[model samples]
Target: MQASTLAALKELALQCARSAGELSLKRMKEPFTVEYKTSASDLVTAVDKEVEKHVISMILKRFPDHGILGEESTFAQDPAQFETLWVIDPIDGTTNYVHQQINFSVSIAVYHKGEGLVGVVYDPSRDELFYAVKGEGAYLNDRPLHLDRIVSLEEALLCTSVFWNKRAEQMGIDLIVKKLAGKVRGMRLLGSAALEMAYVAAGRLDGYVSLSLNAWDFGAGRILVEEAGGRVTTMTGTPLPYNEKSSVMACNPTFYEELQQYLHVAENTQTD
Candidate 1:
């Protein structure tokens, strides 16, 4: 994509993210209906759907032909149909949004044929906006975000999500978590993958891992981390597909190699 076009998309994503975030923040203060999707632990609120609709309308108003792949209301399950696609997670941490009313975020990203062009993640609680235009670098609010390298895992502060299911067991998340928690400087479970990945981009966290996530969950975050000079891939060390569910691991170059080795060890041991 041309630089100008990419910039335009970035601006649109930023606007949509901020607007959706503001709406969600405002609604969070009020009572809203909540429902479960897969289980009681998995939640969705009216605000999530409302914010997604608001964002979709805003994007379509500007670019009617563009496709929208949203968490609440997905237009297309397969993203290959659209030349330009907007991937949105209106409220990334729904449990946080519903219960704690914090740690949640609005995530938005634009892609052209599987290549990320614009990424925006907005945290309404902190009033922080982390954004990136491909080749333009990343920023948190107004400040540039460039991650500094960490030499070793023992010195690294990392975060991860552990969902309870067969997938988690199959991924050997139990072993991975136990190993990393003992090895890293500290471990955290932030509830929001996008926010955690943003923290990794800002160098606030050295790395992040998750056994399962959809495209919308990490769409904006993957771009932010990469633009900030970090690397993101599946836990198995494969490139993430444009709009599919997969595992995620994000960190700097040094951590990628170091962490991947540990990940392989856990997976190999699980198989053995």
Candidate 2:
């Protein structure tokens, strides 16, 4: 795609994210209904669905032919079928939104033929917007985001997601967290994958890892971190599949190899 087209998509993503953020902020103040998807801890609120509906309507108004993959409503059979695909998560930290009322965000990303073109993650409570355009750069609000520090594994502050189950996979994740905590400066679980990844791009966190995430969960975040001069891949250091659920690791380039080694050890040892 042309640079001008990519810029246009980026602007659209920004508009969608900001508008969705405003809606979420407005709805959060009122008492809304909530339901569980998998467990009590895994929740979906009426506001989540409402916000997604509002965002998708905005996108279709601008680009009626574009395909949409959204967390609350639509899921295309194959994103590759469309020349342009929009992946959206209206409320990324739904649990945080329902409980803490902070730390959640609206995430939107545009992809052309499976390649990311633009991304925007907006936190309404903080009024912070993180955006990136392919080949351009990442930014937090008005400031450009680049990981300038050379942080080692020992000095890195990391964020992660914990599985509530006690299955072998959960054991493996626990092992990884235990090992990383021993070596890294600290660890946190922010309950919102998009915000956590945006934080990494903003240099607020040195790294973020999750054993599993859907495309909508990390679409915008992956682009944000990469455009901000960081590395993003699976825990095994392979390319992240654009349309599948998979592990994600977003981190400063300086400490990627070191962290991957720990992931390797935990994956090999704890699962078996």
Candidate 3:
């Protein structure tokens, strides 16, 4: 695609993300209904659907031909084959939103032929927007974001999510967290993958990992973190696929290799 086209789409994404985020913020202060997706812990709120539909409508209004995939809608369908696509998570932390009334976000990323071109993640509560375009720098709000440090695992503050449904998967996740609890400065379950990655991009956290996450959960954050000079890959250190469920390890450059080693140790312990 032409540079101008990409820039236009990036601007559109930013607009949509901010609008959707504000909608979520308004809902945060009001009464909302909750519905369970797979289990009680895997949740959806009325606001999630409303914001997602609104974002999708705006994207299509501007670019009717572009495809859309959202967490609250179209998640089950395959989106990777579309030549041009918008992947969005209207509310990334529904549980947090329902309970803490904070820590949620709206994430949007535009892709051409399965490669991300524009990414925007907005935290309405903090009024922070983390964004990037391919080959351009990343930013948090108006400030340039730089994942400019390398810290050892002992000093890294890594964030992760735990599975609630699959016992096998949850067990593996527990083992990894158990192994890292003492070695890392701290581990946090922010309950929002997008926010966790935004924190990593801003250098507030050294790394973020998850046993498995959907594309909408991390697509925007991946671009922001990578453009900020960080690396993202699977726990075993492979490319993270954007179309399906997968594991992830996003880290500052100085800590990727060490984090990978620790992940390997955790897996070994889980198996043993």
Candidate 4:
């Protein structure tokens, strides 16, 4: 890992995320135009585009050679063409932001040579910032977060998203949820994968698993979880590739193995 590059990216990413999140909070109560993407449940707002544009412009100005992948914008450099890439989700949980004005986050992760080097996720409303550098411990607003104590699945508090409106994958998630619901203390659906992962890193939640996420959704959170003494992998117990589109299963280190076993059982039953 490039320690110096990671440090630099972490500093810049925190700055940009804070600025973008502040912009979002400032306009939260104001009237804004909303648009639909693919379906009514999938949403985007004027603020989402505005924040993404602002962040992209700032990143490009400072690091002209770096490639950017943003939720609301097109990539400037092809994924195959660059060794360093910035994955950005300017406003995660747009639906919650539009209705509740909370739970949204600005996520940024920098990958160097296909490995995550730095990550930052900022929740502007709460002024909560979670960040990590590869080989360095994760932090929540300067306080270090450790996941060493959370070891049991039964004692764990979990979070996951149900694609309730999307029928194709609903059965799979439902079965998983049914198996887990009574075992854990409680389960939450936060509507933002990035924030849920951040919470896991911070020890607020013990684990998270969800399907159909793109690179931008969990890129930052994955690094945070790993740095905070957690493990991140595909739901099928595979290593997460930088560019693949799949489900994410992240949790504290001690519970990951056990959770993987349960996931294997679920998959087997599905196939059987």
How far off is residue 34 in model 2, in Å? 0.5
Candidate 3 CA-lDDT value: 0.83
lDDT minimum window of 10 residues, candidate 4: 162-171
Per-residue lDDT of model 4, residues 73-161, tens digit only? 65655766778888999999999999888899999999887899888999998999999988888999999989989469898899887
Candidate 4, lDDT over the whole model: 0.85
lDDT of 2 by residue, 1-272 (tens): 87777777888899999999999999988999999998898899999998888888888898888888888765535556788999999999999998899999999999888898898999999999999999889999879998989999999999988444364254567765776798999998888899999999999999998877889999999999999999999877888877667778899999899888878865553321
lDDT of 2 at 82: 83
Off by over 4 Å in 3: 74-81, 163-173, 265-272
Clashes of 3: 0
Ranking by lDDT: 2, 1, 4, 3
Reference-based lDDT, each prediction: 0.87, 0.87, 0.83, 0.85
- Write the residue-wise lDDT of candidate 1 on 1-272 in tens digits: 77777778988999999999999988988989999999898999999999999998999899988998998874644556788999999999999998888999999999888899889999999999999888888999979999866558888888888635466677667666787789989998889999999999998888988877889999999999999999998877888887888878898767688888888755543321
lDDT of 1: 0.87
RMSD, one per candidate, in order: 2.3, 2.1, 2.6, 2.3
Comparing 2 and 3 on TM-score, the stronger one: 2
* lDDT for residue 172 in candidate 4, whole number 0-100: 67
Candidate 4 lDDT score at position 204: 93
Pick the winner on lDDT between candidates 3 and 4. Answer: 4
**Model 1 clashing residue pairs (backbone):** none
